[model samples]
Target: MNLISFITKHSQLPVKGVENTVALLNEDCTVPFISRYRKERTGNLDEVQIAAIVNFKAQFEALEKRKSAILKAITEQDALSAELKSKIEAAGDLTTLEDLYLPYKKKRKTKAETAIKNGLQPLAKIIFGQRNDEIDYEASKYLNDAVPNEDDALEGARHIISEWINERSDIRNLIRRQLERFAMITTKVVSTKKEEEKAQKFRDYFDWSESLSRCPSHRLLAILRAENEGFIRVKIEIDDDKALNNIENRLIKANNATTPHLQLAIQDAYKRLLYPSLSKEILRSAKEKADESAIQVFSKNLKQLLLGSPLGEKRILAIDPGFRTGCKLVCLSAQGELQHNETIYPHPPQNDSKGAIKKISSLADAYKIEAIAIGNGTASRETEQLIKRIQFKNPIEVFVVSEAGASIYSASKIAREEFPNYDVTVRGAVSIGRRLADPLAELVKIDAKSIGVGQYQHDVDQNQLKNSLDTVVESCVNTVGVNINTASIPLLSYVSGIGPKLAENIVAYRNENGAFGSRTEIKKVARLGNKAFEQGAAFLRIKNAKNPLDDSAVHPESYPIVQKMVKDQGLALSEIIGNKEVLKKIDLNKYCTESVGLPTLEDIIKELEKPGLDVREKAKVFTFNQNIRTINDLSAGQLLPGIVNNITNFGCFVDIGIKESGLIHISNLSDSFVKDVNEHVSLHQQIIVKVLEVDIPRKRIQLALHK
Candidate 1:
């Protein structure tokens, strides 16, 4: 199929770029590594483009595998022919190939097989050809003990003809086209479950009908979930008469005795076989497209959440707030190590506000806490207000972090391994603190789905979702460049070319010996071969390494080029690193060679300008309006500050310092058409929103973007 050309055409990328990227992928180069380091070979393809190539390459391989299996199965059936083989080989898609092989597939007992057993093939063929005028006489000749009458014999012949019509690729394709273009998806509520409290969430889709092609991805996923949960019945419908007439025009040639038989056969095929098979196929194709769209949205959101602004390496005092159980508090070091843990009941039944304030102030002073991270969960607003009243020795920046998956992380196996003596509350508080300090390093320990940034995540394809989320984590991890010495097993596992096993080995070696002194020292770990090092060394940074470039993004193979540039300029490595004036004066063309082009040289210069500099912005403190605390307190047309916590194709959900989050529909996002919700707002972005509507009974709040 000329796989390279096929991939190039589909991906719409340069042919050479696609080919070279495929070659590198074959050599086990990761997307992050190829996009960052192999710019010359891949024609400067970004991570998204390289990922597309990888996906298309996997698709091509899967198609080829399916074709081979089909060929082998047909050959074993002794039904392979030169023309059929050529047709199957030329088929580009799985649907076309399966259609061509339908007639050769084995099936269980059917009426057609029974009719063929009764010697009715000749009569069926005669009737199908439409050349026989004496179809009754021909049918009578085939009557036997099993088929005692012409009526029975004719019915058998009709069954055989129906089977023949159903298996024709041309007829299936015709029905497929009709369904793809004209099908409507309709849903009906199950009478018994309609009044259930749980089913009220899907009440909007109870009696809905829409064009399947025009239905949005989120809506389709919702309807499908409803159907799966037995709250509704879904159906795909098209015009039956139109489909039958189209098949008749192609199959029936004349108006004779066989004409009526052909008409019946066509009707049976359209009703019993063609419509059912092709309708499901079209719906499945639509579902897959919807799944892809949802996954893309999810992956984008995950990237933003993982790379959210970090309060870099600050000693944090984090609180997981609660009302009756008290707030679980933990103090973390600059490196996110748990130092002390306790509980404070500043709010209600045990209103020991004075004691809580005294304890918090003393702890902040004793641990040198620079920031306070309060989890945005139960009693979060009250806790934030209480913390503001406390008088600390230093001016501490208070940040309210999203605690979506903190509980999940606290109860996980990873948490258990890290803290065997601590309870889930303490671990949860620690996670909240670490997330504020370095989100990427701490969030990788939790599943992306549990982070709650996506919509209908559990409804999508699980395997595809996992692969996509993993890719995003890997890309973000490599892009920011991991601190190899302090990184946990989860963080290091996402580094380029390092899997779970190798990450464990590295950690064990470090615990047994000491921290990695340089990039070269990574090779001393058990079974970390050259290939792994080649792909991983550039992304793993050693702080204060003897060789300065080890902590930068420059690959080891290109270390000589950086050295030559430094030597040519007659400056010490220390003076040249982070010296933008000295770097800007150096001529990049002087270092360009066959392997190293202008792109690589320019990248090297930029890295030296800011060695190991974090690409993410610094975290800033945010405050929600104090007047609004719940749905009842909100009013229409009131402007309130909020944070964008979750985004979807429809719109984004904002936390307005309340128990229920308000939603801003896409239509209200701007004055113009909103093509993408992300273009208007991003995850964790702070903005002001006007309350549009508040339904206290349903616990729903609709909002409009005010800024």
Candidate 2:
């Protein structure tokens, strides 16, 4: 198959774009680098389109590899025929290739193999022909010690016939089509596990039935998870009689003495071979689709969470709130460095609210803290109230940050390396403060799945999930443009071409020397060759560089073009920077070349307009309903402000300043159909919601968009 044509048709992108994108991918260019810097060659394709080409290219290669393996295996077996080889080579999909290869695939000893060994293949063929009315005579002629009687001989022939019918691609395809159109997935609770406490969570799937094609990905994943847990028996079924009739119509061409034998063979083939094999194939296909859908959801959520608003380099006093153990407090500098650590007991056990207030005010005044970040965990509300009571020397904004993966980050090796002397509590507090200052930088340190922004994260394909999350992190990091001097190893690692080793080397070089004064100086880092620099240089920013374009998204390869533009305009490079009036007056067509087109020139102009400007908004202070502290305070029809903390296919979960986050179901998102939950809401978006119902015992809250 023509891979470029295949990708073009599938992605619905321009053929030239797909072709050029694939070529660039083969050159080992990263997605961010290609999409951002090679717009001219790629016809201005975006990151998503380039990534699709990458996926399709991989799929084509895998298919070709499989085809070669199958062909080689068949040739080694001396079963490769001209026609058979053509069919195998022409097969575009795995299903078709495997179906064609089914007849030659080696198998364990079965009744069919045993029958064929007994020399009943001839008899099977004769019976399959349906030309002889004397089947008994033929069976008698084939009788031997192994098949002592005509009845046994006929049974053996039928077994061989069943195997032949099972291997027929047309018959298998017919059954597959039936399954694809009419299959229903049903589940039943395991009788032994019916009353188990762990089984209650999946009780909705107990004795449930749904059309497989129409079943939502989340529901299917849930059912599969339940079955994996041994809490339910999942089955995929179609109208058995309808499916068998369709196969018979396609296979049975005659009615004679062989009619009954053929009917028996058909039934055996349908039950013993076709249904089991094809049903499993269909289920697996469904699972792959579900995995892709879940992974897309995860990737989207991770992107939103990573691109979330940053408070941006502010000195912060962050607290990991608790009651009996007291609140763990850490002061962070504007650069997210840990400055001070202590414990403040303002709630329960110690009940030193006065001392805590004094300490917090004094610390804020001393550290010049711009904001306070409190983890939304145990005693959070009490701590917030206590902090609000304190009259600070300066006005301080308070943010209730999500503590979903704070513990994970705190206990991570990276955290330990950052703060060797501090314990997990201090590290966790520091993470909260840094998250408020810049969410993307701090959140990247923890695993994306542990961030609690995805659905069925553990249940999906692990490798695919990791790759997708990593891509999102990489894209977000490159989009924001990392600071070379201050970015942590994890943050620097996601830059276009810099992996962990290069990131470590860059940091080491910086420590040995000093901050990178220009993009040209990055080559001095150990193991950072020209290729890595070419792909990674544009995404790494050097603030206050001698060459100002180093801090912008413009690639160094385009430096000459920018200099020419400045020279042509008869102005200095510094005068042209952020001079939109002058930039708009210059004709972009003058800089167009064979490699650099109008697209590249336009991008360079845009970068010069606002070099290294963050695409994310600044973080704002949000307060939950002060009167509502827990699930009990929530009531139907009450309007409350909430933040969208997590999103899934079904809906988005809103944190309404409570222990249990309320779910705004897809149906409740808008008056019309909500095809995508993201279309209605995004992660970390602050919105107002109307409480629909509150289940205190179950600790579930149902909400609706206030609008």
Candidate 3:
């Protein structure tokens, strides 16, 4: 099939839609740009659907490349029969293609090749035909120096027949299907490493046995990790007798004297060839599936965390909490510029609460701090309690934020460039505070994997994980529009079609030329062209510009349409913007043109109603039970408020005011069956859960969600 036909069949999208999408992608259109602006062309396909089509198209092309290479290799060997060529050409997936080419594949010499060289081809042919009456006589006639006796000749004949059975596509395909359906995975601890300290974490999986198909993605990854570290030995297997019988029924012709030779050949083929090769392939495939599942989960969690609630622009005081190291504090303006920095020790070793409170209150008064953000690391609870006790001029909100990856960001090149004079501790405090004000803007500076809201992140394929996480970040950034005037370079880099270099140029132009007064000024940035503007204009918002549409998602290319709407309504540009009653009453179809269809018009109407609106909810304050500080404080059946910190295929981890997060398995997410843990819980979602069990030695805590 052709590329468009193949893509259409797999994606279930219209032929025209697939054709247009492929054309747009080939022309260098980004997913966010196409999904937002080219809705009419793609039948309103979302970014996810468009990305799926692109991935499928790439796979189809790769398979074709592999097919060409295989055909060339077989033809070079002078073994390319018409029937073989036809079968290879008709194959759909890699497995089928590889199976069809197995017989022609060149390999090192084996018993079968040796036997064939010893003049045993005729006896093997006779046994394979299974119609000869004098099988022993046929075998004896093949004796030579290499095969001195009838027994030796018969053995060689069986070896040759075994290879013939092993190479048949029909037999190999059936056996592969069987292995996929009934394979079992088992693990045992290495005797020498059983009591080692490093292996203690995987102790529960030492003697684990589970059906390969039913294993959870996280569990399988953990098992593989154990095997990789030499703590356990893993095996993928099926019933040998059943597999041999399956081949016997497919290959054996009849129950005659030759049947005994056939049975011996079947056993030899299975033991020596078929089972070992196919089992390895099955394991590799299963691991790939597991990797995909885990990566998808990580992607979802990262997206949610990146899009978490923002507190909007506000002057803030951020604190990186510690006991002996002291809490590093910084004051930031609404634009997140550092105004002041200091270190305060309110927890033990220097429990001068009165002096610390005085210092914090004086800084708040001096800098007009509107809110307080404290990192949820060592001594966070005490710092929060102390902040609440202080009497300030205004009621400043206190938020306990996750400090994961903050240190990584502090040591990063971005942080060093942004704050050349400040220390790493000061930079970390600033990031903590900036994330509370606007998460998407500050998070883009740090690596997604270091954010710590995922499971099995370090174990998954690195390139696949990066692609998935980058897509999620790109999607989130585009969804919540960027402020072109005040956004940092990292934030601007995620705008469609804009990479790091262009983002830097945009920032430099703004710095030299002042804030962007109009959207047209963006084109003046060096190296920016028409294509980049077209792809990135809609997602980049300029607040309070000379033209009102510039602050909204309305692309400048559609300026004529907007002007027509304003003239028809007999209203000024500012008057028509944010006029919900007027926008809601207007019929978009009357203004739809051949170039701008209903999809485009509908989006314009929506933007006019709520110009430059943020889709994320406002940040909220959550409080855990004061008495519970760690797992030791938790008791069975006691309910406590917590926030989800990480999610995996098996369960989610929650922070219930403890250093060690608690686990609520999929079974305990709700009373009913839950096929997916994310359906019941989300990243950073606050809820009440009951403690089910706690192990002090292992530092494990189990929780169950309340009804």
lDDT of 1 by residue, 536-586 (tens): 999999999999999999999999998898899998989999999999999
Per-model CA lDDT versus the true structure: 0.92, 0.91, 0.89
lDDT of the structure predicted as candidate 1: 0.92
lDDT tens digits by residue: candidate 3, 1-707: 67888788788988888999999999999999899999989989989999888888888898899999999999999999998888888788899998888888897998889999999978898888887877888788888899999889989999999899889888888778888999999999999999999899999899998898888788889999999999999998899999998898888878777889989999999888898898888888888889899999999998899899999999999999999989999999999889999999888899878889999999999999999999999999889989989999987989998888899999999999999998999999999999999988989899999998777788888988998889889999999989988988999999998888999999999999999988888999999999998999888888888888888888788888888888888888788888887777777788887668989888998888888889999999888898987678888899999999999888999999888999998999988899989899999999899899998998999999887
Candidates in order: C-alpha RMSD to true structure: 1.1, 1.2, 2.0
- Model 2, 1-707: lDDT tens digits are 67987787778999888888888888889999999989988989999989888888888888889999999999999999999999988888889999998888999888899998899989899888887887888789988889999998889889998989999998888988888889999999999999999999999999999899999999999999999999999999899999878877876788878888988998998899989999999999999899999999999998998898999988999999998989999998999988899998988888999999999999999999899999988888899999899888888999998888999999999999998998999999998888899999999999998998778988999998998888899999999999999999999999999999999999999999989999999999999999999999999999999999989999999999999999999999999999999999999888888998998888889999999999999998998899998788878999999999999999999988877899999999999988999999999999999999999887889999988
Clashing pairs in 2: none
List candidate 2 segments past 4 Å from native: none
Between which residue pairs do clashes occur in model 1? none
Model 3, CA-based lDDT:
0.89
Best by lDDT: 1
